[model samples]
Target chain A: MKVQISGLCKKYDGKPVLNIDNLTFEQGRIHVIIGPNGSGKSTLVNIISGLEKADHGTVAYGSNQKRFEEVRGSITLVMQHPYLFNTTVFSNIAYGLRCRGADKKQTELLVKEAAEKVNLSAFLTRKAATLSGGEMQRVALARALVLKPELLLLDEATANLDPESIGIIERVIRDFQTATGATVVFITHNIFQARRIAERVYLMMGGRIIEEGSKEKTFGNPESRITREFLRGELIF
Target chain B: MDNITNGFFGALELILSGNREVYGIIGLSLVVSFVSVIISMFFSVPLGIVIGMNRFPFRKAVIMIINTLMGLPPVIAGLVVYLLLSRSGPLGYLRMLHTPQAMVIAQVLLVSPIIIGVTLAGVKDRGNLIQKTAFTLGANRCQALWTIIKECRTSIGASLVAGYGRAISEVGAVMLVGGNIKGHTRVMTTAIVLETNMGNFDQAIAIGIVLLVLFFILNILLQKYQGA
Candidate 1:
């Protein structure tokens, strides 16, 4: 699904944290937003996924121009330090289906499918509270992926994962992208990861999108000075 | 020494023989406290959750009020209920004075604040994460509340158990409102009081034993639910 934002502004404690004049995110491609710490990348994604509100302007989703509440179920965001419900992994994965009133058979089938996709089939019956850190992140991924959200937002969801876990998650994410072809908004500080996964790139510094373009043009052949410095790891905010 | 020994043995006998008076008191105590806690929860649990989850004007003041009421003297509560149900009081026309209904009212008044206070603490401690998680997973407001309730089930159960303990072991409020009417309003705690006042220490000890057993079972159930 396509989303367009214009004249968006968000402030905290009477100071502007995000002040985007205009931005558009298109459908069916993995988009990566890269920035330094406190550069409002997470804030922007949160605004997109309707987790946090923008003080000014609007976020128009898809062709219908649906507001957040109207299409909230179709958008899923798995944040950094993801929280799993104090329940079995299977139940956690099935939660979205259950909330939508899916039947027992459908819930079981879909939950198992999602669990297998994340390679968590063996942990379905285990209590979510007992899982390790990386396993918890996988459960969170399974939970979000099970719903097959039309717009999936990942806000540094794998920031501290082990390399092996990160590799697994990246593979699963690739598999999902190929299968559903849904719009994926990825936020990360890892330039290597951005290079590997980004189909398009947006660079933000000081709460503004200084430059945005396709991956090759944005990262490989940088245009803006800030973008070039960021690519060289010298643009520390 | 002989009196205490005899009282213990007599209590065992009364319990083993299922003495009707003792059993009736035990039954009435359980019924009144159980019903009162159940009704109180319908109002208190939600109140606690709302107060805990949201930020509003005077929230700290409301929390202070609940905390103060948690330590409300049972006698003051009993006196207040007595005035309300007495002949010259506002609710006197209901003619519920000296009845089990009045006892239930007093117990509810005493128990609700305790439940609300404990439950509020539980919600404040762990409500937000589960709620945010549920919302991101596509749960609506009602569903989010249900998920928070499920996540905090252990603390909620403990809160209810605390209320139960306070209600069943209470003496002043139930005694004042119930007027200690035999075979009708007499509960375990009130009966213990009346029997001891009349120098019938054996039956008092016996009833106390039964009360202990009931408390033990209830706490066991609470612990199991908490651990689950």
Candidate 2:
């Protein structure tokens, strides 16, 4: 489903955190958002996923037809911090499906499938709280994926992973997107990883979208000085 | 010095011999404190979770009131319950005065706020992470609530210990309400009071020893749980 965010805005303590005029996410595409620290990338993901309410404007899905709450089950967000339940890995992946009342057999099938997708099948009985950072993120990812959401929102999903873990996560995400045709909105400060994964890129600065375009144009020949400085790892503001 | 030494050894012997009175006090104290803690849990866990997780009008006021109530004097709780159950009082028709039921009521009144207050603090401390994760996982309000409570299980365990500790050691409320009746409403604290007053120093020391041991064991459990 297409996601159209129009005039999305949020403020904390009277200071603006996110202000996007208009942005459209195409179905079945990987959209990456890149910016420096404190660029409101996570805030955007939170607003889009309904975890935080936008102060003004609206986020609609499917050709501006459905509001976020109207299409609630279709979007899933994997937060930057791996929020694991104090339970086994199997239960962590099965949590969302169980909340939706999935039967035992179906839950078992989905749990195994998600774990195998993330190569966590061997750790099903392990406590989620005991996993490493990368494993925790994978469990979070598996949880979101098992819901089969149409729109997957990721806030720095691979931010703290080691190189090997990052490669494994990228492979899993690619396979899941290929099989399910799920649209992905991933936020990261890593330009190199963005280049590797994103079909379209959005540059955010000072709580606003400064520039957006296809990866080649935005990365190779950016329009804004902020974008250029960000690519160069130089101070922008 | 002689009285202290004899009382101490006699108390130990009484416990070792499984003296009927000692067993009676132990059993009564356990039953009363356990019942009170169970009732406190039933009421306070849900109240704590609600107050910790939701935002509504007077939420802060309600929390403040509960916290204040946690520091309420045990004697005052006894007086309040006493007034409620006394003859010609509002609940006098039930005629529950000078009974174990009345003592349980006073203990519940004394400890429910403690349970609620401690559980509230625990829930507040852990509510943020659990609520955020649960909401992101598409959990509805009730599911999110249960998730928060489950996450604070260790804290809830601590609250139970604290409540039971307070209820079991309480002497004022049980003495006033249970009336220290021998073999009927008598608990350890009340029995010790009667024994001490009647110059039965051996029995008083025995009960005191038992109370000290119980408190020590509870403290050890609390420390272990906190470490865990």
Q: For each candidate, what is the lDDT?
A: 0.89, 0.88
After superposition, the stretches of candidate 1 with alpha carbons farther than 4 Å from their true spots are A234-237, B219-228
lDDT of 1 by residue, B131-153 (tens): 87888889999999999888888
TM-scores, all models, native as reference: 0.94, 0.92
**Residue A105, model 1: Cα distance from true site in angstroms:** 2.2
- When candidate 2 is compared with the true two-chain complex, its DockQ is 0.70
Per-residue accuracy of model 2 over B176-201 as CA lDDT, tens digit each: 88888888889998888888888878
Where does the lowest 10-residue lDDT sum fall in candidate 1 chain A?
A: A228-237
lDDT of 2 by residue, A3-110 (tens): 888998899989999888998999998899988888898898888888789999888887657987777877888888867988999999999999889999999999
